[model samples]
Target: MTIKKWFKSGSPWIWLNAGAIAISMIMVVGLLSLILVRGFSHFWPAPIVETTLTQPDGRQVQLLGELSRSQTLPAQVMREAGVDIPSDIDLVTRHLIKQGNRDVWGRDFVWYPETGMDEWRYPKEAMRLERREWGDFYGYPVRLKEEGRTVAEGEKLWPELQQRVDRANELFDEIRGIERGDIGAVNHRMERVRLEERRLDMDRRAGRIDRASMEEATVELEARRAELADEYAVLQQRLDQLYQDVRRDTLVGRVMDGREVEIPVGQIIRAVQPNDMSVVSKVGLYVAQFWDFLSGYPREANTEGGILPAIFGTVTMVFVMSIIVSPFGVLAAIYLREYARQGPLLRVIRISVYNLAGVPSIVFGVFGLGFFVYFVGGAVDQQFFPAALPSPTFGTPGLLWAALTLALLTLPVVIVATEEGLARIPSTIRHGSLALGATKAETLWKVVVPLATPAMMTGLILAIARAAGEVAPLMLVGVVKLAPTLPIDGHFPFIHLERKIMHLGFHIYDVGFQSPNVEAAQPLVYATAMTLVILIVMLNLTAISIRNRLREKYRSESD
Candidate 1:
């Protein structure tokens, strides 16, 4: 066939589209593979290398670390950089070692020339200690201590150290429970009591307070405070006991330079002798660490631990936005497609919605802040939550407002999709239903809307995909660096809409760009981004499954 004939037959366009799709798929697969490799590999335990190196100035230094990476450079460059490379060699190799005793080494990573290294060995006794602060410690366990007194030494110290870590973890759990659980509940109750008193005071100033009621409230408040004070004292005692127990134990480790340092057992997350681990043991530890990353809360300025809060918040916000946007979007689309007259107003509305879909997300965020938070939320707070005045409750950035804002931002997509679905339904079916004496509403709901359900779900899926990855708008609306509590909790009226939340996308942004410890936070960024992508995929899959079911169910009815 001639080129002109192929073009006219649309074969050229089809081939072009296929090529574009293949390229897009390859790019996406490649990106996801890179993320997976970088993220999941972080949990694996690598053998610690202990080696001696000859410095360029003829001095020898001892080093213990993990071989992180290697690179090759021209011999001329190495000599020019004063690296003492041999003149005969065309290229020189150097290794970047992750000597992670950052507190002692002054740096986490260091580059050493291969030519200057000697006596490389992976010591079976070498240990890697993951700490709460000061980064990881690469050393050998010397002894176990209690309040500066040695309790165990040599081989016995390893088992003792493990036992103490387990004990310290338990104590840490108790401390967290007291501070964030029991104490948190007490604090919330005290805040409610304070707000109640302030409400009564305001009523008195306005000459609307009842004397008997005011006296009863005052008595109740005093009794509650007294009860809380007693509970607080008991919690304080437990906290003191935990601190004492935790601080008593310490692990003494000998570094590369043979400098012995004492690290409190409570401050260490895990102490692993990577060089001593068998394959099965290493695999088990790797799985455990990965699971911990999935379920744990972040620490050390979000450079360590897991992002459970972010995952919860992202899922909750997307679920809420889907719930809110679906009905409104479907209803508007139905009116435009089924009920509204074909006129200039309908055309204008369609144009407006499509335009809205193209509007910047940040612009939506600003609008949400101004109109939803400052205006609507402010009014609600004034009328109903006046007790918490001055300190705005609903009139602030929160999960509810974030969900609502995302719903508004993604509404246009739903409207367009639903309208297209409705338009695609044959008019003969509606006419047949009407001819059978069915009312317009009955015909539309039973015949037309049912067939269009799949399209509505398709729109919802798109909206969820878009909203889940959004960080810019959420930053302005409700997403924070850290959330003390989730939006949904055990509290009464369980879904607390007026609470700030952490989001995976925002967490990635913060850890990648805004964290104080950039080097430590870099890997976490990839991990978080991978997690967010997984979450979005799960949500879309659910929506798509529902859409598929609906389509199958309505296939015969539409025909």
Candidate 2:
């Protein structure tokens, strides 16, 4: 039991390993707990407090906001910082009030000492408005207005406002569908027509165009343009109608400053009086907010709303990358482990692949940009899409280039994993298959590959886990702060690999570090981080499940 004796007996090593594992588990649990508490709680309806903030000059200022956070600091530190600390206690309590009427208060959050606040109470009538801009508005509903005229007043206005919001949301959805879908498709088609015309013009300039053929093409192009113009005019008229409907309703609410402001109903995302809300209502609101976070597109420079695009982009890129990396990785591993003559050259190649795994991912991004985009993509554009020249379709940083770069970045891990898996298979199996008149290629493809699927999947899982969380490489390759259009749409060649994409990893970095509204973006950062973790876990779990299923099937066959 002596320390040296225990160490000699390997008990010390066992204890050390246990301690390391315990510490790691604790760290992980703690991190997850912090994220969950901070992230999930953000959706809960917090009561709005109507209070009088007693200023040092003996003047009371009316304030309305949600009580967000509280902290206790040493009184000595408070006093040193020139805060009016009470003499009775060694600690001074302060609370961060989310005074969210940013336009009125000129600030989203404010801190007040306990002693500096008087008659603060959670009022049932106090409202919190989630606006499209200027952040949240803290006020009381004075009335509801439609087209500058009073529609509903007092308590009756609440139900009326809700109805209008529903109507506005529906109209908004319609407008969005028209703008992003129909109009977008029209724009794409129009662009194609323009490109076609350009191509025709180039041919004419080269004296390759027949006069009759050119005239026919011009007529066709003009006819298409006229049709598109008519369609656009009709769409514009419908959009105007929708806009009028969406903008007609307004809420006349009295802010904390006693100023009655008219907030356009179209600008409001949600309005809720949290203090008046029942438990059931609160739960409903919470679910609604959470769902919005999950499904909604981001706004306000990605500080507000959901991250659907980022999620979609991340998953799609990873999926595409997996498809690309799997075969190449497996083939390379096969060549090295099964077929390649082992010598100095083979050893050098193996070492190179391993070293490539250690290369910084951003380097791969640069390589992708230079090689895949500028060189190969430029060649593609020149050879195939010459009309779209200078506009740079595949020649630009895009989803395909990003996926390919990530595939290259993660290929080594896959190769190493596959090699290990291939090496583990008994040579007798291969020999037996060959002995039974099975060709080497057939045995390798059917028997060897099947058994090694789980290992391949494991490598894929690793690759995906790394690729999904990567932001640096993506920034250079394809990721943007916000991508207005998704890579996938109803356009020709349905999956637009040339489109730039939003990625959760990049979104987190942008909101957390690059955002101007740091305080407001903090919660979003935590929530996004938590979401990214969940997404990665889900993807890994899916791959792991497939791997497990394959392993089980093969194991049973072997038995």
Predict model 2's lDDT versus the native. Answer: 0.90
Q: What is the C-alpha lDDT profile of model 1 across 54-74, one tens digit per residue?
A: 876788889899987799998
Best by TM-score: 2
Q: Cα lDDT of model 1 overall?
A: 0.90
lDDT (C-alpha, whole model) for all candidates: 0.90, 0.90
State the lDDT of candidate 2 residue by residue for 1-559, as single tens digits.
Answer: 6877877999878989999999999999999999888988888888888878786668787878888789998989878888766678697788888988777778798878777778778888889888888999988899998888998997699999988888888898999999999899889889989999999999999999999999999999999999998999999999999998899998988988799988999988898999999999999999999999989999877888899999999999999999999999999999998789989999999999999999998899889989998999999999988898888888889999999999999999999999999878888989999999999999999889888888999899999999999988888888899999989887678999999999999999999999877878999988998899999999999999999999999989977
| Candidate 1 local lDDT, residue 227 | 95
Deviating ranges (above 4 Å) for candidate 1: 1-10, 74-92, 556-559
- What is the C-alpha RMSD, rounded to one decimal, of candidate 1? 2.1
Root-mean-square deviation (CA) per prediction? 2.1, 1.8
